[model samples]
Each structure stands twice: as structure tokens, then as C-alpha cells.
Target chain A: MKTVQNNTIRNGIKVALWEIRKLVWNKAFIISLLLTPVIWGLFMGLPRLFEKIGEPAAAPTTYIYIVDEIGIYESLSQKVSDIDNLFLRKHSGPIDDLRNRIEGDENAGYVHITEEIFETRLISVMTGTGDTHIPLAFNTRLKETLTRYELAMHNVEAGDIEKIVAGYFVSVSPVIEESVDPMDRVRKWVPPIFAMIIFFMVFMSGMTTMQSAISDKRDKMIEILLSSVSASSLMYGKIIGNFFAGLIQLAVYLIYALMFIHFLGIPGLGHIPVHQLLSYIISPELPLLLFFALAGYLLFSSIYAGLGATMEDVMNAGNFQGIIMLLPALSALFISPVIGNPEGIIAQIGSYIPFTASIVMILRITLIDLALIEIVIPVVILLASTMFMAKLAGKIFRTGMLMYGKEADPKEMWKWLRQ
Target chain B: METLLNIRNISKQFGKNTVVDQVSFDVHKGEILGVLGPNGAGKTTVIRSIMDIIRPDSGEIRFNFQDNNNFLSQIGYLPEERGLYRDSRVTDILLYLAQLKEYPRDRARKRVLEYLAKFDLENAGKMKIKELSRGMAQKVQFIGAILHEPAILILDEPFSGLDPVSQDVFSEEIRNLARNGVAVLFSSHQMNLVENLCDRIFMIHKGKKVLYDTLLRIKQDFGSFKCEIMSEENIRDKFINFKETEKIEQEGLRTTIYLKKGVEPGQFIQKLPDNISIEEVTIKRDSLHDIFVRTVTEN
Candidate 1:
């Protein structure tokens, strides 16, 4: 009996390998698998290229036209020169001429130093696209210079001006603090992309599971299979087969993605100062990511196998599979924000759930200082859910594989489960 | 003889229709039991129920083996629907299926090669199932079922879609298995083959067993003694004189007589005149096909 059982398992593996080989060699599977990474690489590369083309060649020299009778121009030039990499070009021209040149040249912008119109003691400043750091820093320096000049006209000491500016700085710290090192900011994106990569691999490999199950039934091969091996064994063998296949593809994508990023000299990639990028890529999270990936792969692939068994053909599996496919993709869409704020209610909630946990947990691990308990809790929960789902899927597979000509409904599945 | 398989009061219903009703039969060791029925006659259903493919509404199937623990592993099944993993190579698929039936890897490999060679499919073993012709694929399916050397073999419609040569090969293989004491139960639409191969037959019609007996016994019990007489005189005028004769029909020069129940061929022969030359005298028991039709229509 033990020998018979061993043969059953060995045969199960053989069946699984046969399934994988067929799928791997199929033209459609090959084309679809290759297409995803190529398209993703192109999309990731395109935007950086466009940004490089449209950026200004060099920073424009800072010029301010002062019309104030208080004579604050000299102090402002000194303040502008204090800022690193900022060159101050003082122009004693009409305000209208300054405005025309600033508007005409694309790289240039202007700041007018005049008495405030809205407030009594403040200065009015204007610039184009205020979002840049250069203009904002320049504006702050000019304000400081004017305030010191106004005080000096009343015989206030220059050292007291420094004291006053220092008094205005507040030491504000983040409320939801994270232990992420400042230099590791680039590492934050890796988890989401890693999650996406895993998701893509699992999804594509799941197509193999579906195809194998459907092909077996469609060709009437399942009857022979069932007569020899139990349906549960066949189902598990298929899921495991695809799981290994998924891991292979994922391994290739990891190598290819890193090489591609390195070859293209992506900014803040491998050459980053924090953890050498390569170390971060090989972080402890990698094994955890693999763990979660296997869990996620088995969970989804088992469901896919069940759906495949229940469906009359591969085409009929689409609507059922669409629901499963949308799950991880949808989780990936929301994973970024969750990573950014792991302590948030949504991330905390999603981390505990199986479908969302793989992406959410990876993202959280990268961006936040998660406790051992925090990490283990979701892993345990996801592992438990995977086991339960696999059991349910096995039952469904056993019942559904034998049924033909009609799709199994949820109620019927529930009934089978009861049995 | 020891009963290898006992199916007791098995019945199957699909929705509102009963497909198999109270069907009971047993397969004894070293015997080939033919299940003969028309289309929708529950023959396949009976086979499936025996395999436990579908749960019967009410039935119990018991198999007796030397070791009870190994009973399930000792049975081989071939469904009417031919099923082989289409993308897999013939040898790999056969070995895989054999393993599922509990054959070890080396043994499975050896058996697979032997069976492929036996079927003249040695070179085709490495070919994909999709690349094989329908008949070749069917042979592969047959090998998958029996590769493990099962004690009991159940095949449904094993002769369908086979060339006469292939059919001969299949029949010879089945005979060898039976000679080796492997109890075989097969269902087929080919009445002639069943008539030749079956020791005993169970005829089903509309979810019920119409007749179950040995071929000789069924013929002896339900058959008519037929005689053809060539006579220039009108046989219709003398037909009433013979109380043993009924429903005699004449066409051209041939006269056919249907012997009534309890009528003996010897008694009928004695009544013939010395001048009347009996061109042919045949005790025609119902052919298996005729029995199948009569059984189905009678019920």
C-alpha cells in the first residue's frame, strides 16, 4: 500500500511535468509570457527618455529688479550669493523690461522686490511654475534679506537678524514615524515592482494550469487520469507544476529586470549609495517575497484549476478567471499607497487578507519599520487561508472534473463542500 | 467460480429520468461478461457505476481480491470515451497513467514499451498524442488502462473505431487476459463480437435488465426452430395440420416455419412426408442482435 501510494505521488509529479512541458512549449503561452515583460520594460523606459529630452540645458542666472526707495538691493545680492549654486545678476532696469525678458525666455523667471500690496511690511514676489526648488529657495532668501535690511534702517544689529531667522525654524517630526533610512528611499519602489513581477509570473503560470486542466477534459484525457489517480492528486500536481514554472519565470525576470535596469543606467538603481541596490535586492524580504509568492501562486492556481475543471472549455473559464485575475492586479494598484503608509487602516486590514497580503506585506516591509509580530501575523493568516482555499479547491476539483456539459454553480459547490 | 465483482441493486437517475434501475450483475473470475444494450440503454451507466465514476442512487459494489488492501490497485478501467493527454508523448503518457495505477517507474517503462511493441506502436511511442491517428491514439488509451496488469479489466466499447486487423489484435489480447484469469467485463455495440467473445451476457433496456444468461441458455430458452421447405404444392393449405407450426411465411420457393413453444425439431422432422425434400432445417435461436432488439422492445 505504501508503495502504491508512493507510485501515485510519483505519477502525479509526472502528470504535472507533462502538463507544464506542453504549456511551456505552446506558441500562445510563449508569446504571452514574453510580451508582458517586454511591454512593461518599454513603458518603464519611455517616460525617463521623454523627461531627459524636455529638461532645460542649464539653470538660469537669478536677476531681481528692485524699485524700493529703502535701498535693500545690496543686502539681497549678498543673500542670493549665500545660496549654493545660485548666481545673482543684479540689473538696474525698468520693471517692464525685466518682466518682458523673464516671460520671453523659457528658462528664465523674475522676482520683483517692491513694498507689499496686501501686507504693510512684506515684499511681493512672482515666478513661473512655482513648483521648482530653485525659485522657492531664492524667494525665501530675498524675503530674509529685505527683513534684515528693514531692521538695519532702524539701527538693529546684523547678528540679531540671524537670531530672529533662527527663531522661526521649527523642529517638526513625522507623527507616523518610519525607520527607513533616508538613502533607502530608492529601495521603496522595489517592493511594489517586485510584487507586480510576482503577480505577473503567477498570473501567466496560472494560464498554464487552466490550459492543462481544460485540455485534459476537452480531449477526454481526464477520464483515463481519474481512473488511475484520484482527482485531488491530479489537481495538486497541476498546481505544484505551475507553481514551479512560475518560479522559473520569476527567477528569469529578476535577473533580466536587474540587468535591464543596470544596462540602461536607471537613476538611483544599482549605483545608489544605500545598501548598494544589489544588497537591497538580495534583502531578507526576498525570501519572504518568495514565500508570499508561493502562497499566492498556490492560492490562485488552485482556484484556477477548479475553475478549469468546472468549465466546459478554456473560453468558458474566462469570466470565472477574470474575477481571480482582478484580485492581485487590483491589490497591486492600491499597494503603493499602502506601502507609503503601512500603519494606515487600509494597509493594516489588507495585510491580514490573503489576496492582498502578498503585495501589501512586501510594500510594508520595504517602507515601514514593521515588527516581527506584525510581519508574522499576516504570513500566518495568509498561510492558513491558502491551506483552506486549497482544500476547498481540491473538493471542487474532484467534483467538477467528473461533471461535463454544464458549469458548476456556487450553490452546488457549497453542497459538495458539505459532503 | 469465485465472484470477482458483485454489483447489487444498482440504480442511477439523472434529474427526472432513471437511466439505470435496479441493475444487478456479477463478474466471475476468468469469465468475459458482455453488457449488450442499444443506445441510451444504460450500458455505459452500468460500467460507470461499477467504476464508481458516478454515485448510484442505491447500490453497493464489492470486489473480492486475494488481499483486500490491494483490491483497488488490481482493477483496470477503459471508458468508452477515449482519453489520453493530447500533448504528451505516447510513452510518457502511458507510463504516467501506469504509475497512477501503481506501477513502478522501471516496471511502467518496461510494460509501456512491451505494450507499444505488441500493438506495433514501438516507433510511435515518442510521438505526441495529437500526432497519432485516431486508431493509434485509441490503442494508446487501451494500453493506459491495462499497463499495470490488473486482475479485473472493464472496457467500454473497446472495439469502436478499430480496423478489422486492429480489432483482431484487441480480441486476441482480451482472450489472453482472460486465459490468464483476468475477469473481463466489456460493453460494445458490435453484436457479432460480443456474441463470439462473451461467455455470458446481460442485456439491458431502458434502465432495466431484460435478459441475463449464458449465450447457449438464452438461445435454448427463447429461440425458435426454423425450417425451410421447398414444395410446389401450397404449404398454406397444410400449415393448419401441423399444430407445432405458427406464423409460417412463404416467399417464392422458400417456406419458413416458426416452431411454437414445446415443439421439438425431431417431432417436426417426423411429420414431414417422405416425398417432401427438406431443403434446410435450422433451429434458429434468437441472434444476440435479435435478442437485444426483442428485449428492448418487449420492455
Candidate 2:
């Protein structure tokens, strides 16, 4: 048994080297090796560049054409004046003629206000086109406008409402008493980067694993391979091999990230703090995040290898694969929403699901505090799922390797799984 | 001959359809055994069973597995479909395969180089599998199979795509391997090659064993001998007139006389005309192709 295990591991290493050679030695990956880090460095370095130049108050590019025919324009200006990224311009003409104004600048749209119950509540954003596909960010401006109108209606001084939107007060202990930590504000952005990178690496690498197995079958190399090594060995070799390959790519990206955060001194991107970015990188929870990412990746990749083996043809990749394929994207989608309610029921549910657990748990860890059990539970579940998937993939890959030339029978595939 | 590998009563069924039924054969050291069967006749299934690629539903395929050397590495397999990495260099793929078998790198590389040279694929060692011509690729794939010099070699349709010259090379190498105490179990659609290369032949029809015997014994027991005579005289009537003559055909000056199964060739040839101007008289045993056709169609 020990010898068998040793053989499997040895063969697996060979398999991994084989796969890595195919992937990393390719021209496209070679090009990406050099290009990806530069792109990543510049991307992560942009905020730092902006902070050094210090644009205290830049003029807004998008101006709103505000029309108040009921003689409330001056009063509205005093209360809900020039919102961030949206400056207000008073319009004298009727709202019907605003289409000509919109035709001149698509970004410039007129907001017409009418007196409703004397609250100045009724407003219409008039763009020339019938389908006014306004950006969702405009809703925040509209909500702020309504809030100021309500405050003005109550005759509270406009000067007292400098901070209109919902804001949180963060406390720092030593540096400045009662001052908000800038790190606390940007912490939400940190978790998603981990989640996105994890999800992207896992999902993309998992798909490549499937494509690779299928290519082996197509090339008729699986038979020689099977005769040479056990199916489990082959599976381990492929999974672990490609996993290391993903790590290499990640390592390249990390180097770029380090260079961007620590070295690339772009003055335009001076707003972001390097120390905050470094904190996230060197955070105590980082290891756990990486563990979940790997576990999730294995779970998905095993399923992919199994699917590739059984499907025979790409067209035959059915619902099981479709569901597995959607999982990473779904996990990534959970990232943004979980940032808001990290301790909510949806997040807790996501943390338990092996598919979404990697991103969800990391997001939860980033935003909220949890006991030891919360982290352990999802990781344990993910590890179990990974083993199960690996087993299923082994059986299916073994059976399907020799299935050659015929349409893969779904019934036979089920039998293999059951066996 | 000692049976190096014994397949006893092995049967396989895919769904309700039986693919291999009660199939049995043996491969002995220093012997070349041919497994001849028509298309869809259980040949590949039986070979795969021996390789343990698929488990047989019934019966045991026992190899003389040794602890000192990996038995799997001691067996070289050249599948009919001929699988190799199309994009990989021959040396790299060969090295990886040998490594999987636990072969030492230097020795495996040395053996691979030796075989590549022997098979006239020296330059192809650097080429990708897809870059090689079909014959060259087949040679490279064959070298890959034997680089470790396995004790037992199972080659399925090894000569299917080879030209005559390369076929001769394979035939020579197969005999050379058998002489060097390696067991070879060969399967091919080419009957004459099977007859020329194999010492013993096992035949199947519709997943059932129909004939299993030495090539000489198969000719002696299952078929009649034919006498070919070159004569100006009409020897056809003389042979047809004889009671022992089962089949008689006259073509130009040559006449072929097949004796009845129960009657020996000596019984009919003695009664032929002495004054028939016979120039040459040679007896021909049934070819493997003829026997194969007869057994399959009849069974």
C-alpha cells in the first residue's frame, strides 16, 4: 500500500510537470507572464499615484440641467447645491425643449422639479431618448436631492447638513482620539480582491483542467497514460500540477502587486495608502483565505476533470458541468453583496456552501469577526467536497479514457459514478 | 512452453451484449502468439482484459507478477488507436512514459535512442508526434512501448498503417524480441502477416473462441492439403475421377487437387497419371487467411 501511494505521488509529479510545461511554456502564457504583472502593478498603483498629487477638490465633469419653473431654483441651489461629480445648472426654457440640450451632450440631462404638496417632491430626469438608461449612480444623487428638499422644507439650516448620506463614525485608539481610520473605509475593497483572484484562478484553472483531459482523450494519449499509471495517480498529477501552475501565475501577479504598491511611484494615483494594502496582504486571515481558495479550486477542478472524461465531446458537457461552471461566478457575485451584510443570513448560508465558501468566508472575515468554528466549518466541508469530487473524477476519467470513438452514454457514466 | 500469462474463461458483457465470452489464451516466453479475429470479434477486448485496462466479468488473467520489477513496466503496450502527444517532442514523451514505469532516466534515454536509431526515427526524436509521417509516428510509438524492454509485449494492430518496408522491420524486431525471451501477443487484420510472424494462433468469431492451436497444427487438423501440379496433360479429370478428391480446379497448365478431409493427400496423389507430363508437384497447406475465413464464416 505504501509503495502504491508512493507510485501515485511520483506519477502525479510527472503528470503535473507535463501539464505545467504545456501551459507555462506556451507563447501566450510567456507573454502574459511579462505583461500581466505590469498591468496589475499599474492597476493597484493608480490610487497611490493619485494620493501623492493631492487633488483636494476637482470640478465635476457631469453637470445637471435643473429647471424649477415654480420659482424654487435659487432655494434648491442653497440646500441641494452641486452634488459631488454632479454640478447643478439652472435652465430657463420649458422641459419639452430639453431634448435639444440632451442631443448636444448625452451626459447632460435636465431634472425638472414641480411643486407637489409644496414639498418640491415631483421631479423628472428628461433625456431625449425614450429609453433613458441612466447610470445607477444617479439614484444616489436623486436621493440626496430629495433629502435636502425635505430638510429645506423643515427650515433646518443648509449649513448644518454638510454630511447628507448615511455615514459611519470609526474610532482609532492612539494616533488621534475619536478620528476615523481611513483603513476602515477601504477594508471592504480589500476582501473582494482576494475573492476575485481566488475565484478567477480556480475557475479558469478548473476549466483548463477539463479542456486538458478532453484534449488527452481526443489525442488518444489516455490509453498509453492509463497503461503506464493508475487513474488516481493521473488525476492527482493533473490537479496538483495545474494547481502549482496557477500558483506560479498568482506569484507573478503578486510580484506585480508588490511593485505597483511599493515601487511604481505614479503621482496621478496618490489617494490610496500602501500601508493599508500591505496590511491586507500580510493579514493573519490571509492564510485561511488561501486555504479556502485552494479547497474550492480542487472541488471545482475535480468536477471539471470528471465532466471532461465523461462528456467525450465538448457539446455533450451537460447540466452537471453547467452548474459547476457557474459556481465560481456565483461565488464572485456573492462577494459584493456580502460586503454589505457580512453577518447576515445570506452570508452565513454562503459560508457553508462549498462553492461560495471561499469568497464568502474571506469577505465575512474581512468585514466581520467570527469564532474559530465558523472558519473551520466551511473549510472542512470544502475539503470533503474536494475528496469526493476527486474520487468521482478518477472513476469517470478511467472509464472514459478507453471509451473511444463512441458517443458517451449518460447511463454508462452514471453506472461508473455509482460503481 | 511455460505460460507467462494465463487468461482463463474470461467473459465480458456491455449491457446485454456479450463482447467477450469464455475467451482464453496464453502467451509464453520466447514465443510470438497471434490473436486473429474479424472486426467486432473481441480481439481488443481480450487484449485490454490482459492489460487490466478493463476488468473481465468472469475468469482470471494471471500474470507472473514479480516483486523485484514492476510487472506493468515489464509489459509494453502498443494500442491499436496509437496514442501519443501530438504536440510533445518524442524524447520528452518517451522519458515521461518510461519514468511512469519507474525506469532510470539515463538507461531509459539510452534505450530510447537505441530504438529510435534501430527504427530509423533518429531525427524524429526531436520532432513533435504530429510532425512525423504516419509510418514514422507508428515507429516512434512502437519505440516508446519497448524502450524499457518489457518481458511481455502486447501489440494490437501494430502493422496496420505501416508500409511494406516498415512492416518488414517490425516483423524482424518481433522475431528478435521473441528470440530474446520476450513474449509477444500480436493482433492484426493482415492474415498473411499473422501466418508469417506468429508461432501459435488463437482465433475468435463473434466473441467466442473458434480456433486455438499452433499454425502447423491448425493446418493439419482443421483443413485439407492441396497438391499443385504443372502438366500439359489434362490431370483435372484424373483427380476428379478419384474417390478421395474433394476439390479439383484446372487453371491453364496448372491443376490444384484438394483431397477429401477423411482421406490423406497420399491416397489421392498415388493414383494420378504417371504419363501426365507432370513438370512440378508441390503440396500446399491451408493459409491462415483461408482457415480464418473458413472458421469465422462457418462458426
Instruction: Give the Cα lDDT of each candidate.
Output: 0.75, 0.78
TM-score of each model's chain B: 0.86, 0.90
TM-score of each: 0.73, 0.76
Error of 2 at B87 (Å): 1.0
On lDDT, the leading prediction is 2
Against the true structure, what is model 2's DockQ? 0.48
- Give the per-residue Cα lDDT of candidate 2 at A320: 64
Model 1 C-alpha lDDT per residue in residues B11-51, reported as the tens digit of each score:
88876799999989899988998988889989888877666
Q: Tell me the lDDT of model 1 at A335.
A: 66
Per-residue accuracy of model 2 over B92-206 as CA lDDT, tens digit each:
8898888877789999999998989898888878888889898888888888888888889999999987899999999999999999999999999898899899999999888
Cα deviation in Å at residue A82, candidate 2? 22
User: What DockQ does every candidate get?
Assistant: 0.35, 0.48
